[model samples]
Target chain A: MPTPEAWAESFTEATNGDAEIGAHGKYYSCSYMLDMQERKLIVDMHRGRVENINLDVQPLDAYEFALRAPADTWRGMGEPVPKPMYHGIWAAAFRKNLSMEGDLLVLMQNLRCFTRQIEILRETGVPV
Target chain B: MPANGRFSPVTGRYVTIDLEDPDLGGEYKVFFLENGEGRPLVCQHTAGCHNHQWRGLLEDPDITRSHRVIAYDLPRHGKSDPPNDREWWKEEYRLTADFFTKFVVALCDALELEDPIFMGSSFGGNVALQLAWRYPDRFGAVIPVEAADYSPGFFLDWWQHPHANAAQVCASGTWDLMAPQSPDQERWKTWFYYTQGSEAFRGDLSFYSVDHDLRDKLEEIDGERCPVIMMTGTYDYLTTPEMTAATAARIKGAEFIEMQDIGHFPMSENYPVFKGYLEQALQRIEERIGATVSGQR
Candidate 1:
């Protein structure tokens, strides 16, 4: 029952806090943060410009990206295909933290990270 | 005896097959053909198409002798009246499915049919699959011809198809022929065409849009009591034989047949060939039902 927004927030928190960034500043990429309910992706750029990277438009799953990426970078690189913006970050963040439904707090953070990645992609015009 | 008296009592006169959902209210006519001594076969017409599509098989002397044929019109098409209500029209595809499911069940209940074989083409084919999936026990056999698996993306893709012809049908309020020439006919055509253009159509399509993969379900159905057969035309622009074959492969014992040199409307395009296929299909149906061509119980 977590709203799409709350799910996004938790997604952002998980990615931002994780410490195991790959050697090339790569981090665990997912179409959606585990916290997000509806298959929305979240990614941590290792402090890279949040406003510059573009997400792919074609939806992809973790398994699919794993198959496409080179062996060494596969785990760290996000999905090969891009996905559409599942939920906007601002709406998700506000609802997750303020709403009575605290269970979705974690998911909202993840959605935040997901939306941020999308925003970055839109700015830079590069596929995520 | 009068020509009217020739009609069988079990066949019943043409009456509206009422749907449970008031939103799907409409009038339909059903003609039941009795084979010497027994109940009849129920043949449902494709939506936006007429019984004439099946004239070839119905008129075939050989096939006619073996099984009874009952052909009826869907709402707002042919002789049937549009449902008085309009809400269902807003969600045409799902409503159509619901209406069809209810209509078939009601027809069986009214006619006191034990278990009847279902024959459908195009949209009728989709209805047959749905009926089989939901009420497997009620059906003895299922024949779905050129039935496209419904999905949200499927409708979008269909709209995008180079030969959709939907827009033409919508604007003209009739399939190229203008066979229904009366004012009432034109009104019915417009209503029917517009329903196909509803957002509900898109939503219904999305609801079933699971990558066009029904192999698991079909396999389960195939293993069940009844037999399922899928037929398609070689030259069908819509619902090609390849698609039908993929659907059939999933069902363990399902039969797949592809008619040669035929198009989307095979029953109309090549009646003789269509009738031949039906003759073979009916033979298989009889074998599965354990009933003779006479249609005894």
Candidate 2:
């Protein structure tokens, strides 16, 4: 697995460079956390661009929503071609051990952009 | 005419049917697309979607030559409006298995179609199973794609939440229902269809995830009479292959075919891939029903 710092840098760069997100993510401003058990990442976006990715997640670090899962599950989801159940949050949460917490309306609001970003994890791979 | 400017042979028409139930009974002007002749193959699109999902199947010369494809929009979906005289807006549109089955039977009666083969995906698929159980003699066969005995959890508030953009949420929420390998253009087209029916998606799921439970009633369906040919895509998390296979196993003489590399909205997301499995299912039905695709009324 890649280090947290390295993974954050690559994810930020890749998310910023994504053309699909750029085309449709003008209003996709939100901050969400990915809790992979071993580590957590809080990604902040501003007008479709990556504002920051915080590796050191404090207890009170607020985010609109959080997707929590085991390290292995994250690895499965980050595969270039994920298996049937690990394809998306709905799939993973329904079939696997992925847990979603916090305000879901915000997640649903930016679902299109967030879903595309999850696909980007396929290219970048998971740090855990 | 230019290649892209050419018009399709498929024709869409409206048929109004009066549902006779004292409670839910009302006039419904349903919209449908049809072409070709022979055995009638009536199709139902997934929840929060329209008959256009069957665009490829309706136009395919292979299927249409031997089968008349009739893809219809359910009431409150696509071009079909809600009950003409009822105060539908006053009450929540929670679809029930009873009303859905009656509506389809009434539609067939109005069109004077004889023993049409019914095929549907997702919610439509669930209703197919219900039809098989309730009205075995009404349909020649039921092709329930990407369905299970009891599909719960999808009937959520997000589709029509007051604070959310129901269109984007419903569309993007179903994004993963298609396999990542499906063509982007077709997947986007399916996504586009979902955007148009956000109002009815959740209501339709009332039957899909809640009222359409056939868990204990699977044995009630006489597969030999109705010939249930269930097909489910491997990538569909909502109705996984295992769930569909289990549901099929309970029905005596029912067959379950697992479709590879496709997802829930098979005909919409990737019709070419879906067509291969569809042909196999149709062949199985023909073998079971002891009738050829060219069999006439």
Candidate 3:
């Protein structure tokens, strides 16, 4: 497992460097959380670029939506070659205990870009 | 035929037909792509999608050589429009199983097809089951791909929610439905098709995730007569192989084929891989139909 600081750096760099997001995420501004059982992260984006990545998330931290799952689930998603059902949040949620909490409408609004951002986890890897 | 250009055997046409549903008799100008020359093989797309999902099957020279493949856009999908005579926008679009089944039958009837083989994926798959149950004597065989007896939890508001770009939400939302092993080009093409059908996607699911249920109706379907052959991809979490197998178990003579390394939209996402399983399915259907032949059926 990578350190939280290391994961944050890779995730931010990967997200910012993504071409698909850059092309299609003109309005993909939103705040979302990745609630891995062992750690939590709030990633804020503005026009497809990562505005900030809060590695040290507080209980008071806010996000429009959050993807919550066990560490194993996050680990599977973080893998470069995730097995079937762990390839995406929807896949994980349907077959595993991964849950999408909070305002899902906002999540759906930015679904296209957010989906790509999550895929970058494959390269960045999870902190847990 | 010309420099830097190639010609495809597949061609497109439009046909107008009256809906056969008892309560709805509206007319529809349906569009379809066709090729080949044998017993009719009618293809249906998944919910919110069009007949283009069968592009791979439509142009396959082997299948086209023996079977006349016809992939049609169920009204309001692709080139098919909504009820032409009614104020369609006045009412919310929620497809009923009765309407969907009748529509397919009417389309086939309009085309004057004889003993057609119906193959559909996702919601199209569910309707294949419905077609088998309701009109056993009509179709030669029904191949329901990535389907089960009951598939709920998909008919949601997110597809057409006002707060989101329905196109992106619908497209990206269903992104994971494909196996990661599929080529990015093919998967993106499927995604592009999805973007064009957000308006009809949720309504189509009305039949798929809501009205289509065959848990108790399976026995009523004489699979030996109509030859019901079901196939589900392993990566399809919505209708897993386990669910499909369980559904097949209850159907007296129906056969289930579990496709590996595929997902919900097999024909669209990964056609080459799906083609092998489809060939096996086609062979099984032929044997079953041959066994149950009564008179020229």
Q: What fraction of the reference structure's interface contacts does model 2 contain?
A: 0.82
Q: Model 1 TM-score?
A: 0.52
Tell me each candidate's TM-score: 0.52, 0.97, 0.97
Write candidate 1's Cα lDDT for B72-189 as tens digits: 6555555555555454456544344665677777777776666677877766676677777767888788888876554222344332134334433232221211111113333334
DockQ of each: 0.01, 0.87, 0.82
Candidate 3 per-residue lDDT over residues B133-185, each given as its tens digit? 99988899999998899998899999999878999999999999998888999
lDDT value for model 3: 0.89
| C-alpha lDDT of candidate 2 relative to the true structure | 0.91
Model 1, position B167, has a per-residue lDDT of 39
Q: Report the C-alpha lDDT of model 2 over B140-173, residue by residue, as the tens digit.
A: 9999999889999988988999888899999999
Better of 2 and 3 by TM-score: 2
Model 2 CAPRI rating: high
- Residue lDDT tens for model 3, A43-127: 8999989999898898899999999999999999989878888989998998999999999988998899999889998898899
- Candidate 2 lDDT tens digits, A1-128: 67888888889899989999989999999999999999898999999999999889999998989999998899999999988888899899999999999998889989999999999999999988
Cα misplacement distance, residue B30 of candidate 2 (Å) = 0.8
Q: Model 3 in CAPRI terms: which quality?
A: high
The weakest ten consecutive residues by lDDT in model 1 chain A span A63-72
Name the top DockQ candidate.
2
Residue B30 miss distance in model 1 (angstroms): 6.5
Consecutive 10-residue window with the lowest summed lDDT within model 1 chain B: B173-182
